[model samples]
Target: MHIKKAIERVPGGLMLIPLLLGACVHTFAPDAGKYFGSFTNGLMTGTVPILAVWFFCMGATINLKATGVVLKKSGTLVLTKILVAWVVAMIATRLLPPGGIQTGLFTGLSVLALVTAMDMTNGGLYAALMQQYGTQEEAGAFVLTSIESGPLVSMLILGATGVAVFEPRLFVGAVLPFLIGFALGNLDAELREFFGRCVHPLIPFFGFALGCSIDLGVIAKSGFTGVFVGLAVIVITGVPLILADKVIGGGNGTAGLAASSTAGAAVANPQIIGNMIPELKPMADSATAITATACLLTAILVPILTAMWARKYEMLRNKEQSAQAAPAQNPSSLAQDGHF
Candidate 1:
């Protein structure tokens, strides 16, 4: 059936397809995962281990000698995304109740969901868009953005904003895998290549595991609200990113637009946070569902917006070049006419 090709046809489909399949199983045939015994159950439920390995492999793929330009570009986007989310969370805190605001349209719109959806950009989507519309260094920028895939940044924003408190060890444990892999990768090229090759194939594995935790019913309930949150994330985070990319990254705003989407890995953050804070458990399910919807919406929208911006930028640059060359060409024509 050429499943890979089919999935590739959809935006973020490689991860999204397996994730939806997992969600279906969890929704319609929840017992199948449990009945299949340890391996299947573990495959469905063991997202942490799968994500740990994915993070390690992801880190290994990053080049240690990445230029300062790439780091700056990536860092600008990352910091902008986190800052936007943090600001949104702080504002939400002031506006909403401690339990969170629940209107008729949206059931579980909280600081957790807002920050989780806004903080992380879809690295795969950004890489793909940049590859098509940007330079090599811009595409390589995903190396830094990938670091935002886990919960550490969200936890930090939450903690820093005084919304949540976490232990020192929790922060360390969250980043340990990526740090270990980054260190090994920098120390040895061969080891980096060896682990780097394993990254792509592991995506669907963890994607499905993440989906297993989501209930489609929650997604249905959050329908319109989820869409609103997704668009909100794009506009809220995208504007600052565009400015940052232009000023710091020295590019047209495509990189910033590219960074607007939510990370698929973000779907796991609510559950992870809930595990640490028991009081948050009730909100986790709804948050995951909402984040998943946001991921889908952003994945579909960011590529289109990036492509349009790139095309417009190219057209403008061409016009400027033609305008500059016209005067030079006219002077040569005038000289030829004088000789005639």
Candidate 2:
């Protein structure tokens, strides 16, 4: 068992290590998230290289023929992801602690804006979701469409609500993932495959970095108070999505991608959080870090837990589906159905 191979299998799982390491540096010797943070020039450089490689692997995963359908569905899902997020944000705000989260709505707006500002069309997570649901074909086109469209539609509606922030730089970050995938697509297969292999290893390194940042201290500040807050946000962010998926999806569909909420929608997220609670920043940085860690954990944990719950839902739904279809199978059954 190559330890390296095992690491890639659990991509986000390992982020705890890095985040912990970062925190340790901050704690022990102190002054850490600074030096290495300098190279974190996600701005000019963009995560294009990493994004490109992930896209390439994603490309390799798909049925080349289905690419067209994937693109169409992706555009639609982007809109859906946005709307779901924004709607969740609006609804969640009323329940928030008020003063709008610190005498302003920063926490409410900034990051959650990015949270709601998504689209599933680009990120590798969508690819992962597609994998979980059997295949692009099995999940059907429209269901996947909603997941991708979620973020786009969220932004549109919220923008209409008169909530705005100034972050032109983030706009670039916002689109970078999709652009990374697109740029890589223009490449030939051999090159793409090579890049994918090369970058895949480094991918989990982020996870390790993410983990190191964690301190039992962050957890303590948050304590049950923070836990409840984070959990509230998670529940706020995910429940409606579950209903929508159950109603429209094929058993285990969008539930698979719930992790996206946890992954850090940093780009447009800050804006959304700000709109609802402007003063969220001072506390937000800490909250967001803790939340990001918690959210990512839930992204995986929720789906797995929900998948179990979904089995029951699916059984109930399937039982009904079967009962309904049974009548069509035979005239005697139709008569029997009416008797019940």
Best by lDDT: 1
Clash numbers, per candidate: 0, 75
Candidate 2 differs from the real structure by a C-alpha RMSD in angstroms, to one decimal, of 7.5
lDDT (Cα) of model 2: 0.43
Native-vs-model 1 lDDT? Answer: 0.87
Worst 10 residues of 2 by lDDT: 143-152
Off by over 4 Å in 2: 1-11, 32-78, 91-164, 167-170, 173-181, 207-216, 223-226, 229-234, 237-239, 246-261, 264-284, 313-340
Quantify all predictions' global Cα lDDT against the true fold.
0.87, 0.43
lDDT of 1 by residue, 1-340 (tens): 7979988887667677888888888898878877898898999998889988988877777776989988988988998898899899889878866666566776788888898999999988899899999999999898888778788898998888777889899999988998889989989999999999888898889889878887788778887877989999999999999999999889899999999999888888888888877776777888887888898899989998999999999999999998988855466687888943
Q: Name the 10 consecutive residues with the lowest summed lDDT in model 1.
A: 96-105
- Tell me the lDDT of model 1 at 320: 94
Per-residue alpha-carbon lDDT of model 2 for 1-340, expressed as tens digits?
Answer: 6865574355343444444455565456444444545555332122334333443344333223445544444434434455655665556455554323442223322333223322222244434554554455434443233223212334344444434343545444434554454456445556455554643454444333433434446544444443344454445545544544445543343543342344432222332344334554344334444454444454455556545654675688899898887744567777788953
Report lDDT (Cα) of residue 69, candidate 1: 84
Tell me, by TM-score, which candidate is best: 1
lDDT, candidate 1, at 294: 91
